[model samples]
Target: MDEIDDSQNPGFPPPSPTKENWRNQYYAYRSPSGEIHYLLLSDFYGHLVKTSEDVIGSRFIKKKLQTATIEDKNEAFKELKPHALALMKDKFGSRVIKSFFEHGLDLQRKGLAEELFGNVYTLSLDQYGCRVIQKALELVDMDQKIKIVRELDNHVNTCLYDDKASHVIRKCVECVPEEHIGVIVSVCVDQIVKLAQHTPGNYILQSILKYCKNTLTQKRVIDGIVSSLVILANNGFGNYVVQCAVEHGKPEDRSKIVEKLAENIVEVSLNRFGSGAIQKCLVFGSHCDRKLILNVILGSTDRNEPLQTIVKGQSGKFVVRTLLKTCDDEQRELILLRIKIHCLEKYLPQED
Candidate 1:
C-alpha cells in the first residue's frame, strides 16, 4: 500500500464529476492506494462520481458494487417476471410494458425476449428505454421478432443519448426489411458543393456523387453531385470522387476524370491536387474512358501544371489504348508522333 492523503490536504476537495468532468476524465488518474479507494465501491451514481480520475482498481470496485446490488438473481427474476410476461398484451401496451422488462433483461432470464415481443409489431418511438428491450431480443431469433427490433434500432438513434449506442443500434437495424428496397439516395449537389467550400472532408461530396451514381436518375441532380465530388476531389478524398466519375453513365467524362486523377496521383505538380484520387483514377478508370483523356495528359505538361503526371507510373490496357489514340493522322504528325513515341516509351516497356 502507498501513503494516503487526507481530504484536508493540498488539492483537497477534488472537483466533482459533471459532464465536463466526464470529458476531462479520460486523462485523469487516481492514486490506487488513496483513502478514497473505498468510495469507488459505491453504486452507479458513485461510479460516475469516482470516475473523475481513471484508476485500474476503481473498475473492479465498481463491478463488485453492481454485483452486490443483486441479492439472489433468481428471486430478482421472479419479482420482475410477471410484468415482463405482460408486455406482449398489445402493440402500444407492449411498447409501454417493455420498460418493466429491463430488470429481467439485466438478469438474463430465460425465454424473456419471446415472452415480450411475441405480440408487438413495432418498437416504441420512445427509445430511451429501448436499449434493454434490444438486448433481450438478441436471445430470440425469429424473423418477425428480429424485424420489429431492427426497426426499433433504425429510428432509435434520433432519440438515444449515447453516441456509440446510437451508432450500434442503427447498424443492427440495417437487417433486410420485409419490403426494404435500397436506400433512396438524394443528394443536394449545390448544398454539398457549398458545404465542401468550408468543410475539409471530401468524402461527404463523394458520398453525394455515389448517391447520384447509384440512383442514376434526375440528371441535374447527378450533375450537381458529380461537380461537387469533382470540385472537392481537389481536396483529399480523391479515390471516392473518382469512383463517382467512373460510375456516371456519361461515358464521355470518364477519360477526363481518369486522366486528372492519374496526373495528380503520379506527381504532386499542383499543391491543390489530391494524389490518392489521381492514383485510383489511373488504375481503375483509364481504360474505360480514354478517348477524351488527352486534356488531362497535356494539362500535366504546362509549366503552370495543375497536376504531376497523367498516368500513375504504370502501364495497363487503358494506358496502352490511351497512347495509341494520342493523335489522328491529319494532325501535326511530328508533334503527335513525339507524344505517341514518349507515351509508348513510358508505358510499353512496363506492359511487356
Candidate 2:
C-alpha cells in the first residue's frame, strides 16, 4: 500500500467501543492521523473526551450539539460527563462543555451542575473554567444558581479583584436575582470606596449600580460614591466609577454630582480624570446645575484667574468648550466677553 499522508485532512468518528473489554475502551483507542475537519454527533460516541480536548475537534462537537438529536446528545453526554471537571478547566474542553450548557438537554445541564458543585470557586478563578461557570449560571435552574454563587459567598472580594474570576462576579451581579447577591452587594457596600479605586473591582461596583436601581442596595452604593465623589473623580481609576454614576444614577443624583464637583471646580478642571467628570456635568446636569457649573467656570477672583487657568490646561480647555456648548446663550456671551484675548486664539470652539 502507498503511504497515507498525515497532512491530509483525516476525519475520525469518535472513539468506538473495543471488543476486548469495557475497561479496554480508553486504552484501545489509538491516536488518529491528520486535522479533524468535521465530526457528527453520532461520531462523538466513544472518543468524546479526546475530541473535546482537541482544538478543531472540540469546536466541531460544539457546533454539532446545537442541532443534534436528543438521543445523540445524551450519548455524547454519557461519555463526556465523567470528565466534566477536568474538561471545565481544559482550554478547548471548556468551550465544548459550555456549548452543552447552551444547547444540550435541560436534564443534562443539571448533571453538569452537579459536577461543578464544590469546585465553583476554584473554577471561577480559572481562565477557562470561569466561562463554564458563567454559562451554567445563566442556563441552570435557581437551585444551581444559588449553589454556584454560594461557592463565592465569602470569596466575593477575591473574585472581584481577580482578572479571570472578576468576570464571574460580574456575571452573578448581572444574571442572578437580587436576593441571591446580598453577600456580594454587602461586601461591596462595606468596601465601596476601596473597591471603586481598584481597576477590576470598580466594574463590579459599576454593574450593581447599573442593574440594581430602585433596590436599596443600589441607593446605598450611589450614596457611598456621591459622598466620596470628589475624591473618586480625582483618582486615576476611580474616575470610571464616578462616570458610572452620571450614566446610571438617578436625575437628582446627577445634580448632586454637579454641585459637589463645582465646589472644587478649578482644581478638578485642571486635572485629567477630574476634568472628565466636569464634562459629564456639562452634558448630564440639569439647567440649574449647568448654571452652577458656568458660574464656577467664570470664576470669582480679580481678573477671573480660574477661567484663565482653566483655558490653558489640556483637558481643562476641552472642558471650557463643552461648557460653552451646554450653557445658555446669555452665559456664552458673558464667557466670550471675559476671554476677549482668547477669542482670536483656538482656546474657544468655533460655532457650527
Candidate 3:
C-alpha cells in the first residue's frame, strides 16, 4: 500500500506519549458532582483490585458494596470471585470479603462460599483468613456451614489451641447448626479437660458449653469438666469455662458442679477467681445443691466461722450475697442469725 499520510487516516490515531494524556485515559469526570473519579483502564476490575490492596481503600469499597444496587453488587462479585481466596488472606481485603457475606445477596454469598469451601481449614488457620471463614460459617447455609466445619473435623483439637484458629472453632461451636454442633463437640469432648486448662482452649470449651444444645452432649462435656472442677475453677481463663457450665449445663450437671465446689467450699469461696464459680453454682444449682452450699458456708461446727470469713472479704462477700438471695426463708434466717452473731453486718449495707 502507498504510504498514506497517516494523520489523514480517520480509522486510527497515533498514540499520545505524554503522561497527562495517559493519565486521562484512566480517569473520568462525574456530571452530578463535577468531580474526577479514577477508572480502571487495563483491567476490567482494576479499581476494586486496587482498593483491596489498602486498608482505607478496602473499607471504603466495603461501604460502597454494602449500599450498591443488586446489579452493581453482582458485577462486583464476578470481579472478586477469582481472587476471593487471596483476598481472604489479606488484612483489608479480608474485611471486604466478610462484608460481602454479611450484606451481599444470596447468589453473591453462594459464589463466595464456593471460593471458600475446600480451603476452609487452611483459611481457618490463617490470622486474617480465619476471621473471614468464621464470618462465613456464621452466615452461610447448613450445607456450606457443614462443609466448612468438616474441613476442621479431624483438626478440631489442634485448632482449639491455635491463636487464630481457636476463634474460628469457637464460632463453629457457638453458631453451627444443632446437627453439626455434635460433630465439633465430639472431636473436642475427649480433650475437654486439657482444653479447659489451656489459655486459648479454655474459651473454646466455654463456647461449647454455652451453645451445644444436645442434652447428652452437654452432660458429656460437663462431666468431663466436672472431673476437673477445682483446677478449672481456680484458673483465670478456665474459671469462665466453669462459670459457663454452671450457666448453661443441665440441672443435674450444675448440681454435680455445686457438689464438687461444696466439697471444698471454704477454699473455693476464699479464692478470688473461684469465688465467682461458687456464685454461679448458687445461681443455677438445684434446690438441694443450694442448700448444700449454704450448709458449707454455715460452718461444719455451727461456729459460723466460715460464714464470717466469707462476708469479711470483698470477693467472698459477693458469694455471701448470692447465698442470701437464693436461700430459703428458714435458711435465710439462719444465715442472717450467723451474720449477726459474727457482727458481719458492716460488710453489707442495711435495707432502707
Candidate 4:
C-alpha cells in the first residue's frame, strides 16, 4: 500500500488525535470592534447535537436555545428530538430541553410537548426531567396541558409524595384547566390528611387549596384537613397545610380550624411551627373566634400569665403581634396592659 500523509496534501487538514483538539482547531476571529469571538466551522446546531453529552457542549446548546433566533431554535429542537428522552434525563441536557420549552417557537414548543406526551409522568417524576415537565405545563397551551395532566391522572398521589415529582404535581394543580384540575383533586382529596402530613406531599395539598377553584372542592379539602386539624397544626410541614386551609378555606371551615386551635391555643402558640398556624387563625378566624383566642391567651379578666409567657418567647411574640393588629379596642388595651405589667415592653412597639 502506498503511504499517503494527509499533511502532504494541501487540500486536506491533518487529523487530531482527540476530539478536544479538533474542536480547538477552530479559531477565534477579531471583529471590527477589536473583540475576539470564537466561531464554529460546522453548523452550531449540528455541533451541539453531536456533542450534547458533553457538559460544556450541553450548556452551549442551552445558551443558544435561550438567545438564538426562532428559526435557529426550531432547527435545534429538530436536531435534539431523537435524543429528547435521553437529554431530558441528562443533568445538563435537561436544561437545554427546558430552554427549548421556554424560548422555542409555538410549533417547536407544541412538537416538543407532543413528543413527551406519553412519558409525561416519567419525566415529571425524574429529578431533571421533572423540571422540563414543569416548564411545559407553564408555557404550553391548554390542550397540551390537558394531555400532560391526563398522563399524571393515574399517578397523582404517587407524584405528590415523591420529592421531585411533587413540584410537577403542584404546577399541574396551579396551571391545568378546571376539567383537569378536577382529575387531580379527585385523586388527592380523599388522601388530603395523609398528603398534608408528608414532607413534600404537603406542598401538593397546599397547591390544591390555593388553586382548585371549585367552591365545593375547596370545602371538601378543608373538611378533610380540619378533621385532623390539631395533628396538622402541630406537624412540621403539615402546619403550612393548616395555614393554607385557614387562608383559603370557607368561612365555616375557618371557624372549625379556629375552634380546634382555640382548644389548644397555648400549646400551639408555644410551638416552633404551630404558632404560625395559630396566628393565621387570628387573621382569618371569625370575630368571635378571635375573641375566643384572646380569652384563651389572656385567661380571665384577672390574670394574663399566658399572654406574659407567650410574649416572652420567640414564635409566640409574632402570634401576639398578630393578635394586637386584629384585636378590638378593649382587647387591645388589656393586651397592652399585660405587656406593661410583664415588662416585655421591648417586644412591643412604643407609641409615638
Candidate 5:
C-alpha cells in the first residue's frame, strides 16, 4: 500500500465503521495459482476493507492500508475519504468491546465463587485481586485459589513503588483472619520501620504504624512489651510518630509507666541536680505538669504573682475550676478568694 498524500488533496473524511469499500472481515486469500486475492468490492466484506491514503495524515493512511489495496488512483482517492470515516466508527466499538471484556472477566470470577460457596464465601481481602481469590477458595477447588493468589502476586510485585501498593497491603492485612494477625503484624512493623527510618514522613510507613495501634495491647504491662518492640525497631527516630508514642503510653491504669521508664535517668542526677526526667517532663509536656505547678503556687506565701500568671495563661477556667471543684473546702475558698482578687474580670464568658 502507498503512503498518504501530503499535497492539497482534501483530507479523507473522519473515520466511520459503517462505510464500506473493500474486504470487510479481515480475511485475505492466496489462490492455488500463487496469486493473492481479496474479496471483490461487490461483496459487503470487500467494501468494508476500503483503503484511504490520499486524504488523511501518514499514520492514519498507513494503518488503513494494512488490510487492502486500491487498483486505480482515482478510485483510491474516492475510497480514502470513506476509509477514514469508517476508522472513526470502528474505534468506539473496539474500545467498548475491550472494556466489556475486562469488566466481564472480573464479574465472572465473582459469580463463579458465589455459585460455589453459596453464602460462605465473602470477597473481603484487599491484596492484588486477592479478595476474589479469597471468595473463590471457599467454593471452588483449592488449586483455583492458588492460581488466583499467584496471578495477584505478579501484579502486586510490578507496583512495589507505587503509592497504591502500600494501601493494598494494609487492606490485605486487615482482611487477614485474627489467627494470622501476629505474623502479618510482625512483618508490617518491620517493613514500616525500615521504609520510614530514612525519611520519617513516608506516608505508607506512617499508615502501617497507625494501623498497628489497633493491634497493640492496651494493658499497661503488655504496653511495655509493645513499647520495647517499637523502641528496638525505631530507636533514635525523632519523628512525630515517636512523639506520639511518648503520649501513647498512658493506659487506663495510669500506673505511671512513663515515670517507671524514665526513673533511672531521674535517679542518676542525685539530689543536687534533682530529677532530670521530671525536668524533661516539665519541658516536653504541659497537661500533666500543670498539677506540679499548681501545688507550688498553693504552697507559696506570696501567691498573687503565680496565680496571675496562671490566670493570664487562660488555663484558669477549665484547669482552675476543676482543681477547685476537686479540692477540699478550705483549698476551694482560698482559690476563689484569689480569683476574686486577680482574675474576676476575665471570669465572664464572651457570647458568640
Candidate 6:
C-alpha cells in the first residue's frame, strides 16, 4: 500500500497484475501473520479507497465494476459508498465512481446518489466532481435527476459561463424533461439581449433551440434572441445565435428577424456578421421573407444606385451573391441586369 505513491516508478504502464512484480507493487500487502501477500479482487475489502486513488488500482477497480460478479462489485461498493463524495473529487477516484454508475445496479446507484445528495451543486462545478454529476444525470432516474439538477437553481449564471460547469447545465437541459428544468430556463429568465450577445451564453441558447422542442418552450427561447435581433445580428459572437434562430425558429419568427434586418437592410447586409443573419434569413425564410429582404436591397428598383451600392461594398457583395444563389429566376433577372449594366459602366469608362 505504501508503494501506491506512483512518483517512484517511471515505467510506462507500471507493473501489470499478471507481472512477476505484481505482489511487490501497490496492491501487494501483508497477511495477519505480518508476511506479504498478493492482493486479489476478493481481498479488496478495506483498501478500496486507498487503492482506488492510485492510477493502476483505480483502473483495476473500474474494470471489475464493469465485468465482475455482483458479489465482487458489492464488496468494493461496501467500502466505497461512504467515501463517494470525497472520492468524486479525487483525480482517480472520480473515474471509478463514474464506472460504478455505468455498471452498478439501481439500488447501488441510488445508494451512491444519496451520498451525493446535498453536494450536487458543489460537485457540478468541481473539475473532477462535474464528471461524476454528468454521469449520474445520464444514468440516474428522473426523480433523482430533478433533485441533482434542482441544486443548480441560482448557481446557473456562474455555471453557464464556466468552462467545466456549463456542460453540467447543458446536460440538464439536454437530458432532463422540459417541465423539470425550469432552472435552465431561468438562466435566460429575463430573455434579454445580453444573453444572445454573450459568447458563452450562446451555447445555452443554441441548446435550448435544438433540444427544447415544446412550442411555448421553444418560443421563449426564440423570442429571447428575436428581441435582440438587430443587436445580435451586428455582433461578432451574437450572430451565431441569430443564424441558429433563423435555421430553427418558426416561419413567423424568421419573418420577424427578416423584418428587423430589413429595417436597415443595406447596413445590416454590409456589417461583418450581420450580413450572415440576412443570408440565413434568405436560406430559411419564406418566399415573402426573401423578397422582403430583396426589395430592401433592391431599393429604388427603377434605378441602379441601390444595386451599385450593395454590389460595391465587400460584405454586401456576398449578401447579393447569396441572394442570387437562393432567389428564383424572375428576381434574379431583375438584379442581374443592373449588375451587368453597372460592370459595363465601371469597366467601359471611355469618356476620356
Q: Mind giving the per-residue lDDT tens digits that candidate 5 earns over 124-183?
A: 222323333332443344444434333344344232234434443444333443233444
Q: Estimate TM-scores for all models.
A: 0.36, 0.85, 0.83, 0.83, 0.29, 0.77
Task: Pick the lDDT winner.
Answer: 2
| Candidate 1: tens digits of C-alpha lDDT, residues 1-352 | 2323434443522344333323211213233344433332232232232331233223332233335445433443444345553333333333323333443344343445545453322333323334434544443344644544444433432423233233223333333332231221222233445434432223333444443343443354435445544455654444344455556435456555554444443243232344344434444453444323434544535331221233323323234333444444443253345446455345333333
- Give residue 254's error in model 6 in angstroms: 1.4
lDDT of each: 0.39, 0.81, 0.78, 0.78, 0.36, 0.78
**Where is model 3 poorest over a 10-residue stretch in terms of lDDT?**
9-18
Candidate 3, residues 86-140: lDDT per residue as tens digits?
Answer: 9999988899899899989998888899898788888888989999988988888
Predicted structure 5, TM vs. truth: 0.29
**lDDT, residue 339, model 5:** 73
Better of 2 and 6 by lDDT: 2
In TM-score terms, candidate 6 sits at 0.77
Residue 121 shift from truth in candidate 3, angstroms: 1.8
How far out, in Å, is residue 21 in model 6?
A: 9.6
**lDDT value, residue 338 of candidate 4:** 81
Q: In TM-score terms, which candidate is top? A: 2
Distance from true position, residue 226, model 5, in Å?
Answer: 8.5
Once superposed on the true structure, which residue ranges of model 2 sit more than 4 Å away at CA?
A: 1-39, 341-344, 349-352
lDDT of 4: 0.78
Clashing residue pairs in all predictions, respectively, total 4, 2, 0, 0, 20, 0
lDDT of 4 by residue, 36-126 (tens): 4454323454555545665655655555566677567666777888888888888877887887888788888888888788898888878
> Which candidate model has the greater TM-score, 1 or 2?
2
